[model samples]
Target: MHSSNLRLEEPIRMASILEPSKPNFFPAMTKIVGTLGPKSRTVEIISGCLNAGMSVARFDFSWGDTEFHQETLDNLKKAIKSMKKLCAVMLDTVGPELQVVNKSEHPISLQADTMVVLTPDQDKEASSNLLPINFHGLSKAVKKGDTIFIGQYLFTGNETTSVWLEVDEVKGEDVVCMIKNSATLSGQLYTFHVSQIHIDLPTLTDKDKEVIRTWGVRNSIDILSLSYTRHAEDIRHARDYLSKLDGLDQTQIFAKIENIEGLKHFDEILQEADGVILSRGTLGIDLPSEKVFLFQKAAIYKCNVAGKPVVVTRVVDSMADNLRPTRAEATDVANAVLDGCDAILLGAETLRGFYPVESISTVGRICSEAEKVFNQDLYFKKTSKHVGEEISHLESIASSAVRAAIVVKASVIICFTSSGRAARLIAKYRPTMPILSVVIPQLKTNQLRWTFTGAFEVQYLLCFSSCSWLPLPS
Candidate 1:
């Protein structure tokens, strides 16, 4: 019997498959990473996301505790088991970001032009007149007349609840500021920005280390998205830390470019990181709003030439509240797909959004449509030219395979990869046909490890006999 018709009795773990021979196959080469939160933590929602084409489930450690994340992880596993779909799990660390904490369980309203004290003291509970920040050098970092903006405005562009303040005095550990605008403040993590000054902080925090040591190791996450990645050293530090752990040593590290410093050292960071995530939300705050798009294009192009996977987030942020994306947002998603990004990450749109499932479906639809117009041949030429003199053996094989596929008018390219490198190399050539990758089962769990690569689909075979192979069309 032919491999395409071959069937196995034993169960196998597989991700969503793309069949080029079938009319129903939705060929969206760009993957989707959906953030899991209160609104989308249930198995049903996760399953919906999976069916809608979510390739990864991301848990933001900035907001949830170990217990909460563990519950969500369990729910995700249940959904994967029930749906029999392989979805990679990612842990997004808090890094050295600053946030506000209050004594009141409820949000406090701050009136404009009122004086309030901002302290780094965790022991002090925030009141209507005082707010506590997570960082300790608040007083030393700010001087009189310096401006401070607090809220999620930078991240979500929702300025309705954000507060602006101007520093009036620095007293020991407390910085007194006069509120420039009226806004409601909550305990939710808020981005801190000071005008004309760089607040130096460690790349990874104590809480981040604790979370990785405790929750990350326990769950055996597939990816770690290091927030506020400033330099190559940060990536090395994270890799070093993970190397000490048993199962986590294999975890892929993705550096998130969020600030101006990160962008300044992006080349170094990219060389060290397994992948890169263009975090437009925080990047917008660090640079002019208009420049963000330019940076996005440049970063994506570089990652493509380097044969590294890059993910773009905050593409359809408006869909967090609305059922459908705006025309511009839709265009943005399409543009990202056209730019050759490996993945699009949905943060607020899925995390706390009212329409998580619809968001994923919408992005996936946009990507599929945009992919139709992608000039794959041109991209391939450009990528090959960029690799000029130093093409490796794997690159030559991958390039040849893609060329052969095109010349033969093949329906799909199926690659059996042990470390997923061959599949990634093939994907780097930008083949029009879908590439299906088969990986061996991991020894620890006796399950196929689904590492994030540019492959269109993946499957894990327990053994050689258990493989349900699919032959190339003749």
Candidate 2:
């Protein structure tokens, strides 16, 4: 019988639904990350996202300023208080990236087959004939006859607004290029792609370190998503920089696999980073668009075997404008869930989408349905076999707990966690039943540690010095 046609809901039970007191339980195992922007930064929208199943709130540091992010963070705290839900805040840094610097207030228009000068001078203002980029080594990096694609390459996959330029001549600190296509160039951070050319750029920019020291430290973000992670050294650098901060030592660093270099050294990067985010849109630009899906599947599978949380973004790009996603987008979300990704990150769908709430709800529903059809037993067997004979005591207990739950047809597996390690271990086995992780509030920072645990639901347990448990305040 087809797995989708088979109803697996009858055999397994949900303890939260059966009990009267646990009204706050969320059953969806797959977490949803909602990017906060102008459209969804308000308290009402954020609260709606939370109720609709947004587990993480992401702030894109590339666009907004420190003041704007602070306002958004303030609004997020208000929404969390109003909704009484725990949502993790993720700070996405603008890594070593190049962007067109347009000094004019309005967008500059370029004509097709027109000659233009590309310079690395930051002070130089961009015009119809001249364009400035953020990278200092722009001329040194690209040789004559190289192609540079600008606009609509990062985050958004809209190719209609993209401008293509072919390098004609390489002069001192300037590369003259002819615009292959006429497009309006907006002053936004765009992905600069030179086909098959690896631009030697630092993983972390000075701005990235400053953001970590200021905004990241101020807000106490739960996750620091390193953009364009090339290798393990990138993760280590970001981790080391974050450690130097006062309270950011525990901040989780998620390596974003966007370019070919990142994919080349993904295993080592994954070992160093706390989690991984597959940026399909950016990867599509770096590689052939056709191979993005293959890379996504491979990266997700590798992360699953490693027992690290993996997040897939750009699943529903069309949902930014439309209320309902395309049939292909729906299937894509379901496939990612079936692929065993721990979370699905909504980029434009939530950041500037017209229907943010509906998008979250739509993804949540798809995740819950897809999870029902997921082959947990087969997955567990494969994952366990990957561990082989060498296993830690925690892994043994976690594997046993999952096996015992399946044997007894348990409603839910309840585990008390201090550091959330044991809970994360059990979640790695991918049990059919939800794992409720109850964390004891020993340190205040421990509360945010459960953000990426992959647990179905997390609750805080109130305890006294006498070791007596009390019900969490409603």
Candidate 3:
């Protein structure tokens, strides 16, 4: 019923046990974003994620050095080339984050009601007890009664540990603080503040800038995730920096809403950013633990209203250690899908977990089951805020195609998409029938599967794109 020249490659060797000729359409729409780390950094492991239903490969810049990340990027590229897969590399920024620096070789243990001085500059007065913070302008940002949490989570208006700080006084670089919670701390990087304080720091570190010019641009990094995004200005600054390297138009910027300010300024950040990452771990540090769930739900719904793709990260922290996820973790992922998240990101679970591949595997399954009862009709009703004044011909055609498929009870809706625009519009409408969108190799191989590049493909129509989709047995 189609052109003889059209040859669409439905991957016979895709990641799931389900038959590719007849995929479980439910699982393909929700993507699994796996991070590359010690457990899964090699070409083999990276390819494993691709075969395991993962659509995105996240590179956590928080811990690794430049050489290490560069090598990882090299391996990722090699894997993509070897397998001939199309996957997006998410380059995550380390910070504009604050860390506690001390002169003591051992970790410091502070008792409740104790006095601890946090200074932006080096503390010369008390060498043994002084806490030197990496973030500048802390003294100017905090007021009396503002709380500082060091690895402590506040849940349901109750403090988990007494190892927290309350701002007592501020003078220049010196911030006089009293320990409200007793926490033994060392040279652990990253800080959480109850105070909605903005700091003076470059959005991207100098090293981040250098890497952007190198691996970020040259290595074809698809998404640059800006961590600790506090304001819209942060994204603008990053865009300006990317522009300098001529990579502004080439890549998309994803803002990671980690703190209270980021949550408040998400609208502004969304205005400049291509998408959003609900950085839950850092959010736990900044807000009450119980509040994080509520915030995530709100953030996802709000992002949908704004038409920005939002990826929820660190949903399965316990799975990093445990082989199987806790019941709560499974529920958490389901809720994210129910909330209409574009994707869910696995951080430590895929990066340093015992079962990297299995984690990615499980997440896909959970999202699949969740999507079964996702209430697509109700979701559309709630999420649709505005419609275009003029319905474009493309929309008209896409809608008609879906309707026709449903009427005929067609197993699939195949669209010969050249630019992928028509295919996206069809999938966005979330037709009950499956979609098999045929596209040029301009779209990635991963784009072949799932509704959001899942469970869909048209015959590979060769074109003028740089990447080519070769013939694979259906």
The backbone clash count of each candidate, in order, is 0, 0, 19
Candidate 2 accuracy as lDDT = 0.78
What is the per-residue lDDT of model 3 for residues 110-205, given as tens digits with 9 covering 90 to 100? Answer: 777878788776454323246777767787788998877764222212243225778888877788888776555544443445556676776688
- Model 2 worst lDDT window (10 residues): 460-469
Question: Please, what are the lDDT tens digits per residue for candidate 1 over residues 1-474?
Answer: 232111222343233224232233643667888999999999999999988878788999878789999999999999989987777788899887777876455787889889999888877877768888888877877799987778863556565678888999999998999998788876645667775455678788888989989998888878889998989999999999999986787788899988888899999999999889998877776677788889998998888887778899898889999999989999999888788888899988999899999999889778876666677777878889998868899889998899899899987888876566777788787787777765643333336664443222232111010012232221
- Native-to-model Cα distance after best TM-score fit, residue 55 in candidate 1, in Å: 0.8
Q: Which stretches of candidate 2 lie over 4 Å from their true place?
A: 1-27, 152-155, 188-191, 443-474
* TM-score of every model versus the real structure: 0.85, 0.86, 0.77
The Cα RMSD of model 2 versus the native structure comes to 6.6
- How does each model score on lDDT? 0.78, 0.78, 0.67
Candidate 3's TM-score reads 0.77
lDDT of 1 at 63: 81
